[model samples]
Target: MRLIAFGESFVAGVGDPDHLGWVGRALAGRRAVTLYNLGVRGATSTKLASLWRREAEARLSDEEPCRIVFSFGVNDTWHAAGEARVTPAQSLLNARAMLTEAASLCPVLLVGPPPIPDAGRQARIEALNENFKLLCARLQVPFIDVFRPLAADGLWVCEAAAWDGAHPGAAGYQRMADLIAAHPLWRAFTLAE
Candidate 1:
C-alpha cells in the first residue's frame, strides 16, 4: 500500500531533528508500503482542505492502492490569537468535507491534532477532535484520536517530549506512531497485506 499523508508542520515533523514524522516511523522497515509526508508548516485546515487534491494528485500512483491521512487543526487553534477563543465549528465541518472528497478516491484516515500545553487551547483542540471523530464515524472512515489519550498523562508538558508546546519531539512522535500501529485500521492494512 502507498499512503499519502497531508497536513501542517506537525505532520511535517518540524521539531524532529531526525526529520522523520509519524509517517516515516509508521512505515519503518515495511517493504510492502511507501509513505509520503506532505505536511507543511503554518498551514490551516482551510488551506489544507483547499489544496489537498492538487497535492495528493502528484503523490498518487496506480501501481498500488493508496491511503490518505488527514492530520491538521493545531494551527487553527493557535491561530485563534488567544487562549479562550473558540475555533469556529465550521472549521471542523470544512475539514470533514475535504477529507470526504479525498475518501472518494481512496481510503482516508482522520488523525486528530496532538495535545497542546495551554488548558484553554486544549479545550478547543478536544472539541475540534471530537467533531472530527464524529464526522469520521459518519463517513465510515478510520479515526485516530490523539488528543485525550495524550493529555491524560500530562504528556505535553514534558520538556524533552514536545518543544514549542504544540509539536511533539521524537519520543512523542514515537508514542503517536505506536498508537496508530495498534489501531484496528492500521493493523488491518499492515497485517492483511
Candidate 2:
C-alpha cells in the first residue's frame, strides 16, 4: 500500500516535539506500506487541489494499493484584509473537485480541520467542517470529523494554545492518531489487502 497524506501544517505535524505528527504516529509500525506526507505549512485547499495530483502521481504504483488522506481548512479559514483566505463556498468547490478526482484514482479519506484557539477563526473552521462533511457524504467518501472532538479536548486545546495556537504538541497529535486509529472507515481501509 502507498498512502499520500495531503493538507497543511497540521498534517505536517508542526508543533509536535517529536515531529512525528499524527500521520507518522498513525502509520507507525506499518512497515509494509510506503507513506508520503505531502502536507505543506500554511497551504489551503486550493493549493492542495492544484498540487495533489502531481504529488501523488509521483509516488503511486500500479502494483500497490494507493490511498489518499486529506485534512485542511485551518488555513482556508484564516482571514486577510477582512476576508477568508478561501471562502466557504470556494473551499467546497475545491474539495469537491479534488475528492472527485482522488476517489477515481484510489480510496480516499478526509479528516476535517482541527480547532484553533481563536473563537472567530474556530467558527469559520466549524463552518468549513460542516461543509466538508456534506460534500463527503454526497460524494460517498469516508469523512472523519476531528474538529469537534479536539475542540473540546483539554490536551489539544492547551498544547495548541501554548504553542502556535493552531498546531498541537505530541500528546495532542497522539489523541488525533488514536481517533483516526479507532475510526471504522480507517479500519476498513487498512484491512483491505
Query: Please, what are the lDDT tens digits per residue for candidate 1 over residues 3-106?
Result: 88888887898877779877677777788877788898988888887788998898888888888888888778764334423255767677878877998888
Candidate 2 accuracy as TM-score: 0.97
**How do the residues 1-193 of candidate 2 rate in per-residue lDDT, one tens digit apiece?**
8889999998999998898899888877888868798889999999999999999889888997889999999899889999889989999999999999999999999999998888999898998899999999999999999889988876887888898788889999999988887888887776533
Error of 2 at 24 (Å): 0.8
Each prediction's whole-model lDDT (CA): 0.77, 0.89
Candidate 1 lDDT for residue 140: 88
Maximum-TM-score candidate: 2
**Cα deviation of 128, candidate 2, in Å:** 0.8
Give Cα distance to truth, residue 65, candidate 1, Å.
0.8
User: TM-score for every candidate vs. truth?
Assistant: 0.89, 0.97
